[model samples]
Target chain A: MLSIRDLVTSYGNIEALRGISLDAAEGEVTCLLGPNGAGKTTTLFTIAGILTAKSGAVVLNGEDMTRLRAAEVVSRGIALVPENRLVFPRMDVEDNLRAGAYSRRASAAEIAADVADMYRRFPRLEERKDQLAGTLSGGEQQMLAIARGLMARPRILLMDEPSIGLAPMIVAEIFDIIRELNREGVTILLVEQNARMALDVAHKFYLIEGGRITFSGSPGEIEQDEVIQRAYLGSRQG
Target chain B: MIDFIQNTVDGVMFGSSYALLAIGFTIVFGVMRRLNLAFGASIMLGAYMGTWLHVHYQVHVLVVAVTTVACTVLVGIYVERLCFHAVRRDAALASMVSSFVIWMQLEEAAIHLLPERTYAFPGLFAAGSYEAGPFLFRTEQTAMLLLAAVMVGALHLLLHRTRFGLALRATSENPLAAAYMGIHRTWTVLCAFVLMSLAGGVAGFAILATDQQITPFFGLWATFKGLIAMMLGGMGSLPGAILGGLLLGVVEAHALWYLGAEYRDLSAFLLLFAMLVSRPGGLLGQRILSREELAFRRV
Candidate 1:
């Protein structure tokens, strides 16, 4: 479980997230939906400790993790698949997976087993195990990024715009993967633009805009709500 | 023909040391995308520390060399912590300017400690030459060449065969993503400084052994030459650094032989200018991560 309370984050003179609060319950996918410049990415980054929050706290399983460094956050069983799937382009697919397990004190055999498990789950990665990650297709790179995050074996997986620029079929496959991951007990904090697809997988949803949580509800409630229908579904009549 | 062959061999032997220096210089640039201008000071530290150990403490030459390397690595860590790491997030330009200040302070320290314009460096190997067929080689020259080769080979292994190496390369390629994967950025940067300083220290030993002189000003000269070799080979390419140093030395040797000694320094610049014009990336340089790629983008 992850809890974010009154988080404020900024970049120089610009405030990206102002007094925003949200939560992702254990073994459930909590989706944050918003248009561009809504601080969705900023919230994930602050939770991951990549972007420092000026105020408030990030609590993971009741432990305060607000002051930890990015790597320290990873070590504490939280892994972030950043926006744009920033895999080390020069590194081989297998090596990138290994990097995800960097802070683990596991033996070489255990790490290799985890990598083998990843390969089994993502067969495409296994086919191009030795190939450079940068050479992969956009869909493949996104897969690699998710596989890499899973390599950490994190208790919580925070993904920012995983389906961005991906083809529809690939996006469907990514959502399927997300459902499978949640079934396996990996709590997810998902930031997405595709509200329809997100609502299908996410147990709970929060609509964010202008650096604040404008609405929060179950998928059923969100569907019936007129404000959500007008803003996200874009008027059924039109 | 024998004379030409002999001269070329000698040039390569000397060039091995230059290659070592360039390796030290370029690896830092590869990882951090910022020049540690105090690199030459690391070399100077090795020389001065080795001399001090030899003269005052009566340490064995081999022991002095090893200790000098250890000491320089510490100095390198100190430099990284104070000059580079402290202001790392501010701007790349900040680290660069801070390194210049560190280099000045290091140079000043060297001068204050030595005071003498030049001091003789005691040789580890005995003074003599060995004959192999028609070629005569100095014992020290062969040792320097062997040391450089071994060090470079070891460095190659470190970069490829170890987890630390993988983490370092990962961090260099993407610092933020590397952090997400649990690679400590500060530790990786510190590791790079340690490796580079070791290379510079060995290079300093080679310089002291081959030329048998140490001066505070030699730090500046060493930085200039190492940087030239790094550029000639390609900025962040390891193989390029080695090849660049060898090429520079060979060209200079030929220049001295044909055009006379006065044209020696001119030869290196000519080669660099030619490389810049023909291949701006250097011989082994790839445009994989350029200044644009490494630039800090404000979120």
Candidate 2:
């Protein structure tokens, strides 16, 4: 379980996350939905320790990790699959997976076993194990990014925009993967713009607007709200 | 024709030292994405440490060599802490200017220790030449070339076959993502500094021992040669560093033989200028990404 309490983070004078608080229970997909410039990505970054918070605390099951650096955050069992699927462009697929497990002290054999597991889950990666990650299709890159995060063997996986630019069919596939991961009991904190698909998989969802949480409910509750329907689902469902 | 071949042989032998120096620059630049202008000055100061020990205590050559490398690493750490680690990450220009300031400080420190224009450097081989067919090879230059090859090979293995290498390459490619993967950004940069300093110490020792002399100007000369060689081969590329150094050496050797000593440096600069004009990326530099790739990355 992860608890973020009144976290405030800023870039110079502009505050991206202004005292926003949220909770992600174990084995649940907690989704944060927001429009552009709504501080969704910033919240995830602060929790991952890539961006230092100006105040407040991030508690993982109890111990405070508010001041830990990014590496320390990963070692503490949080892995972030960053926005845009930022895989190492020049390294081969295998090497990229190896890099994902860098913070852990796993042996060569252990790591090889984990790599095999990843290849089994995503056979396309094994087929292109020797190819440069930069040349992979966008869908493949997204899969690699997810696999790379899983390589960390973290209890909490924070994925930012896993289906941003993929085709509709690919988006459905990604949502299926998310559901599969949640079923496997991997705690996920997802930031997404696709409210329909996100609601389909999210256990509990929160609506963030202008760096503040304005709504929180179950999928059924959100579907019945007129304002939520008009604001988020109107374009597609209409 | 024999003269040309002999000159090329000598050029390649001498170019080995430049290759070592350029490799140091490339490694540091590759990881940090910032230039350490004090690279040569730190090496010069380390070499000065060796010469001072030899001059004052009459120590063995092995001790002098070890002292040079150890001292260079120390000075290199100092530069990394003050000029790089202390500076903010986004302020790359500030770090460069800070390194330039440290270069001046190191130069003054070395001068204070020696207080002389030049001093004798202990040589590895006596005055002799080896005959291999028609070409003559100086004993010390051959030793220099062999040592350079060994060091480069060792460095290649270290980079391609280690966990540290994976972390380093990942950091170089994407610092933020590397962090997300749990790689320590500061520690990786610090280790790169140490690696570059070790190579630099060996290079300074090789060149000084071959020339059999040391001077204050060695700092400026080493920095310029290494920078030019790095730019020529391709910035942030290891193989490019080696090629650039060898090419610079061969060109300078021929120029010195044909057009007098004055044209040696002039010819080298001319070659650099032409290379920049024609291929700004250098011989093996990575080309700019395609527009489609760039657009995808942005999204």
Candidate 3:
């Protein structure tokens, strides 16, 4: 559903995304795996139109979204969960969810229904609906962030490092939520350092390094690659 | 005892105007995290414009008010476009300097428009006073108090109960995330200036009603008091701004009553200094901007 071609993004004099390109098909979990400072987040930001691209195009279902503003990008049906789950800390859970639907002109009834649907899916958030988001536990805050993104009712949801810093059990729960969301046919573009978890969920994977796509293949092919196993999976020998 | 009660009552009535001005000043700061030094100029312009319309054309009070508000809002948009928008991404100092230049220009406009240094604001109400036990009160003072309350209450409702309020708070908390959710950053900033400009109009009207005179210098005085009131309450705290304004008024009133008029401005500055030394963040402020954030590096 999304196509990026030869995208180049920079911050001042330093280029973070240098001619990187990738594709995320409709109804699939596409994962981008890379080490620190590998431009994984930069790629996602450029695609979301939060950062301007020096060169390249981001196409969503045949329409170019590269030059659109971030809010306009959301209107075109793309929602980003953002790095670090930057939920509105002072706003209540319900308010944050409401904020997600800001770009939509949906009826009040539809919004209420969607909010209700979110509460039903994440019962913990339902219980803490009135509490400030900052006061929630890390797991709960992560859930709120995802729910906030879903509130946009976008066809494509981009999540960055959804499992970083969560407990193992919580991480598993997050993965389950991702799977559940994908099953509902929401295309996901996931950025993660957890190669194992990403490999399990993603239908296609791209490994990026130094602002370039180093490798691209199906998870089956990636698991069998010796170099990737040693570098990303910590194998004993390549 | 009667004198003390009388001064306090007057102070409170006058404080409502200060509260309105400070609230407008602080809301813009809270949302933009930038100081709008030209806000005082806006207040001055509002007063001058309203008075000029009333005095020149014998316009109705309501008409004067509407015209003043509309004109001030447009001027605010103009100031944002001219002074604020370009420097927004640069640094706080850059915006402050730009706004200061605009402020001086606004004063110059006022001087040229009104050759006299001061213009008497035709009273909005008739010459009347009411007596409550030993206290005497002007009818306009009570009206000013009521108007301020209604305005603040309406503003509170707008911020808490509306979707626009949600978007505003979201933008204030994190502009990038707000943009991700489809809130237009530039529109939000513009809306903030609009809201503050409207507040400035109401405040200017109340101030003119109380003082019965409008001067080019009033803009600087209003800005100083508004800034002091905002800081005394806390930078980002709404209720804190209102309370701080009221407190400053009461403090100044008592200082003038006991120590003579010379201490009036001195007391306001002293209170500000005391707050800075004891609680640099103000009474209700959660956090002061760090050096980097204050410089607009982190925002």
C-alpha DockQ of every model: 0.79, 0.85, 0.85
Better of 1 and 3 by lDDT: 3
* Model 3 residue B127 CA deviation in Å: 3.7
User: What TM-score goes with each of the models?
Assistant: 0.93, 0.95, 0.94
Reference A-B contact fraction recovered by candidate 3: 0.92
Q: CA lDDT of each candidate?
A: 0.87, 0.92, 0.88
Give me the runs in candidate 2 sitting further than 4 Å from their true place.
A235-238, B289-299
Q: Which lDDT value does model 1 have at B223?
A: 88
lDDT (10s digit) by residue, model 1, range B142-245: 88889999999999899876789889888878887888888887788889999999998888887787777788877887788799899889887889999988
Q: Kindly list the per-residue Cα lDDT of model 1 for residues A2-36, writing each as its tens digit.
A: 99999999999898888988889999999999999
Native RMSD of candidate 2 (Å): 2.8
How many pairs collide in each candidate, listed in order? 0, 0, 0
TM-score rank, highest first?
A: 2, 3, 1
